[model samples]
Target: MASFKKTATGWRADVFKKGIRRSKTFRAKREAVAWSNQIEYEIEQGHHDTGAAPPNATMYHILERYRDDVSPKKRGARWEVTRLNQMMRDPLLADVKLSDVGPRHFSAWRDKRLKEVSGSTVNREFNLLTHACKLAWREWQWLKEHPMAGVSRPPENKPRDRVITDAEIESYVETSGFSFKTPPATVLSRVGAMFLFASETAMRGGEICKMKKTDIDFNKRVVYIPETKTGVPRWVPLSTKAIKILNHVLDYTKGTPTVFCVTASQRDALSRKIMKKAGLEGINFHDTRRTALTRLSQKFGPMELAKISGHQDLKILQSVYYAPDPSDLVEKLE
Candidate 1:
């Protein structure tokens, strides 16, 4: 027999038969009912494993299950799914059995990864795998112990202070074939407009890509972000320059619900292409946040800056996003 109940998080399904019990929670009632039905069917056919881990299960198997079952529930599901898929493609990690996986495998992977990417990238990947291992050990019963428990994380890297200058923004825009007179009809032109908008607004690339036309209130000069990286909703007050950029984008993307026609991946790819064409190096789309936040800091106090940047931690906002020129500070002091 199966029973279903609504919980604060979602729906919970419980199945019991022949002295065996299974339970799971899902974000939707349909998913819960489907899982319970599958469990009941397996039990009736005697195919269900009575609390025993599969003999041939591997690290890849655990991560695959996590990617499919857990990642979709997260706010950063797209990035998590992409990274999990990339990790599973590695034969060294994928082929190792769950019982055989230990600190040594991850340690080797960490060292090899450092040679290919930055310490920051390695640390993010480590955090993802660590969580996956923890869930597999505690909840899934796929491992006897946590595989990442013995592994050491890479050293934290210095936070990026790269601030995009006004001249560089112009160069990028010119190289991307966009001008004030031109319509933002092409992907490159739209991406350039997005870059300019980021510098004026300090919105993240993902947030900008997810924006809809209805989110903006021109009369109020505010944009409502329903979903943010921190999972908190915020209203970002707009500047005159930011409003001008929004109006330009609105003109081209008329009739579409989305404010920007480009996807996040397209924006990223086109950004790289335009930057290279402009002969710019070492600057990324995210640097616009630092630039805009730093510029905004001159006009607004720390508390106001935190609200605009969607940063919950003032320490992070000060340390990471607020990069000021020493010359400007000296002038202010004088």
Candidate 2:
């Protein structure tokens, strides 16, 4: 006989006959009922293979397949590969077989991981595993259910609200880490321009650093980003200050095709020097993007802001980047 019941997370289907018992859970009630009916029919007709998976196949195998086949197609393939490597180091998780893995296994792993890393890191790794399990179940038919669907994920911290100030920017650009000795004029100039460009364009440091002359339209005062983090191409309008910075770079590096000719390490080293000189605490290059987006939100609507920022989702822009000033509300009340 076969029966179905609803659980807190989903519907559970159980089949019991001839001293053999089998059970599985589904997120949908109809799926559970259908599974139960199929199993009951199979049992009555004298042919039910018990849905057993190959014994040697394990989570490690599935993750390896995903890494080799799926990760390269993603924009964040390096990150996905890193996560897979991290998971492979866990012996217990690596040895877990497709048929034996259940919600309890994931629950225990989640509890153990939370003690070692930040909740956000664990959340990201969990998402990767969830996708792997979903692919196995839907595409490979290696699993009857997704174990992660019933597991609890760790809570993540809210987006940072730190916005860089103009005075701090000026201090960073001039006499940054040069109290005892003079810094390289060319390097400091490039670093200062990079900071100004990020603040004015709301473009990421990597995007700005890799920019070439062909990506810009001087007549239109716009820079076309061919590849962005979201895998979308966007044309970012240049501010007057941004144009001046580019013009200065052209005068300095006359033959270089790249707007910023410095390497990432060079950029980071200069950023550290500026931070030390400015005596600024808890500010980073990314904060410049937050500050630019917050200021721009006041002048542009969501659609225009999305176009300028290359944001696929406005909710992310509203919640994470747009830091509304409380002083504006106070002024209105006054």
How high is each candidate's TM-score? 0.85, 0.71
The lDDT values for all models are 0.87, 0.78
Which candidate ranks first by TM-score, i.e. highest?
1
- Candidate 2 lDDT tens digits, 238-309: 988889778777666667767768766678888887787778889998888988987787778899998988
On residues 91-198, what C-alpha lDDT tens digit does candidate 1 reach at each position? 878778887999999998899889989999999999999999998899878788988887888888999999998899999988887666867889888888889989
- Where is model 2 more than 4 Å wrong at Cα? 1-55, 174-192, 251-257, 262-278, 328-334
lDDT of 2 at 232: 88
